[model samples]
Target: MALKYSNKINKIRTFALSLIFIGIAIMYVGIFFKQSMIVMSLLMIIGCLATLSSAAVYAWIGLLSTKAVQVTCPNCSKVTKMLGRVDACMYCREPLTLDPNLEGKEFNENYNRKKQPVNKEN
Candidate 1:
């Protein structure tokens, strides 16, 4: 499949981690603006907001984890959590789907999008 996919939880975790790093970097930049009280304060506020947002994201992930389906990956035989109709194995990166109709089909993120029924007039 041309589509590149990764575990949903893993992806969100990565984002949360990156947000933390970004927050630290932003705060560090604030140090350079020490001569300007307004600029430094602004930078610090932005950094704090970034860090706080990451914490919220992490909390949201915890909530999602509770709802995710736990399944054993056949390819790796490892237990993994899936978020939607299809997701990749957390350990082995094996693609998995809860829907049988999607089995062996090309992996597409668009499959997750809601499809509208087409109207036909005879």
Candidate 2:
């Protein structure tokens, strides 16, 4: 079966969530090395860094969300946020686009990177 893509924000949120879990797991594993203070400290530090990085990712997503266009998904009839010229519905995974030229065409992520009259420099 082919893989399904999720909304960019949702994907990033999932990643951050996973990182929190991974950090906790690493800290738990460190308990096994109680005899080695240096190893235990290193493991704890790594775990803390993972969680801190996850927090940063969450903050970044929040900033991106402000720039995302809010639209009602026709497929699901629900309000959702889109990040670029094209995106998928967060609820139904239905493809959506803001460009009139792209309507009725196959959804391609490259459409976001395609050169256009408007400048959207990062």
Candidate 3:
């Protein structure tokens, strides 16, 4: 089976944006429960929590952005950030690798895992 790939940072940022929209939708629905003050208040609180969580996720993304390696994507000729040994370009979804040995190989998330050292003396 072929694997579908997307930039990790883009995927996470999309999720965070979705959370904000969902939180707004939930809060809008709370208006329909105007008869019960308690229920409406509870829904509002939940919505607020969702929005706040999205903000936290955005902040975490900022931290990750700092650690990710920035490179110019050959596919799009645009700069993008990569989190691991293998990652997709943010704009063009082109597979990329930091290791020369893995260049041109099939894209695999396993490449991101730490490799066991081989004994060169053997």
Candidate 4:
């Protein structure tokens, strides 16, 4: 089975979008407890918080996106933003990299992690 790759920015945006729906679902469930004001109110408050947090996440990723490097995907020719050493094209899911050394290497999310030197003594 082939593993699918996705753009990091797009993934985060999808997650934030899901949060809005989840919050709405929570609020909808609260309707069943209409007889109990406290339960209904508590659910409503939690739902609002979830929705608001999603907005915050959107804002944060938006800011970070502005700082990401924009590059044309060699495979699709469409411009896409990338973060860290390796990322996938937003439009085509093509693997992309800013580092020349990592070019042509198998795409791995682990490439983004900082490499730590091995402690031979240990």
Candidate 5:
């Protein structure tokens, strides 16, 4: 069975890239409405906003890159950045975790969430 998980950073990067393309597509569509100045301008404005937001997302990813831990992926032996507690190798898609206790366990995104209290006998 193949794991479907992808590196969080890579996923966000893909989203950012898509946003740029979508913005450009929207702007292109605006050209079709040359006769309607109001509609064309509105589309252009929306497209510009989308492009600007994508830029902001890129900036956010830059900040996140600084916080992500850089480690050599054991599976592929390539350098990859990991965010949160669990992430996949950017190149190999091998699941990774920083927590020792969770090592060798099935990869789950929930591991990155806040842990709930476990009931125990005193």
Candidate 6:
């Protein structure tokens, strides 16, 4: 089985976008309990928080994006921003790497991790 990879920046942006819709859905549901002022208010508050959190996420990603390195993808020949040592091309989803040692090696997200998991053998 092959694992599909997506650009980290795009993935975070998608999550933030979904949060907005989820917040709107929550607020819409609050309309059903109009009779209960407390319930309605609580739902509205939670919904607003969700929406605000998404904004924060957007801002954070924006900051990270500014720091990301820009590179032209070999497969797509289009410019894209990438974080860490390994990431997929935003436009083509082609695996990319900065380290010469990792070139031609199988793409693994673990390359970005600070610590490698111990392999236990019996």
Worst 10 residues of 3 by lDDT: 113-122
What candidate 5 gets wrong by more than 4 Å, as runs, is 115-122
Better model by TM-score: candidate 1 vs candidate 4: 4
Model 1 C-alpha lDDT per residue in residues 17-67, reported as the tens digit of each score: 999999999999999999999999999999999999999999999999999
Q: Per TM-score, what order, best first?
A: 6, 4, 1, 5, 2, 3
Report the C-alpha lDDT of model 2 over 3-121, residue by residue, as the tens digit.
45579889999999999999988998889999999999999999999999999999999999999999999978999999988888899888889999889966777788857445366
Model 4 C-alpha lDDT versus the unseen true structure = 0.91
Q: Judged by lDDT, which candidate is best?
A: 6
Better of 2 and 3 by lDDT: 3
- Rank by lDDT, highest first: 6, 4, 5, 3, 1, 2
lDDT of 5 by residue, 39-115 (tens): 99999999999899999999999999999999999988999999999999999999999999888877988888788
Q: Cα lDDT of all candidates, in order?
A: 0.89, 0.88, 0.90, 0.91, 0.91, 0.92
Please list the residue runs of candidate 6 whose C-alpha ends up more than 4 Å from where it truly belongs after superposition: 1-3, 118-122
Q: For model 2, state the Cα shift of residue 77 in Å.
A: 0.9
TM-score computed on alpha carbons, candidate 2: 0.86
- Looking at model 3, residue 112 earns an lDDT score of 84
* Ten-residue stretch with the least lDDT total in model 1: 113-122
How close is every model to the real structure, measured as TM-score? 0.90, 0.86, 0.82, 0.90, 0.89, 0.92
Per-residue lDDT tens digits for candidate 4, residues 7-89, read 99999999999999999999999999999999999999989989999999999999999999999999999999999989999
Clashing pairs in 5: none
Of 2 and 6, the candidate ahead on lDDT is 6
lDDT of 6 by residue, 14-96 (tens): 99999999999999999888999999989998899999999999999999999999999999899999998899999889999
Q: List the residue pairs that clash in candidate 3.
A: none
Reference-based TM-score, model 3: 0.82
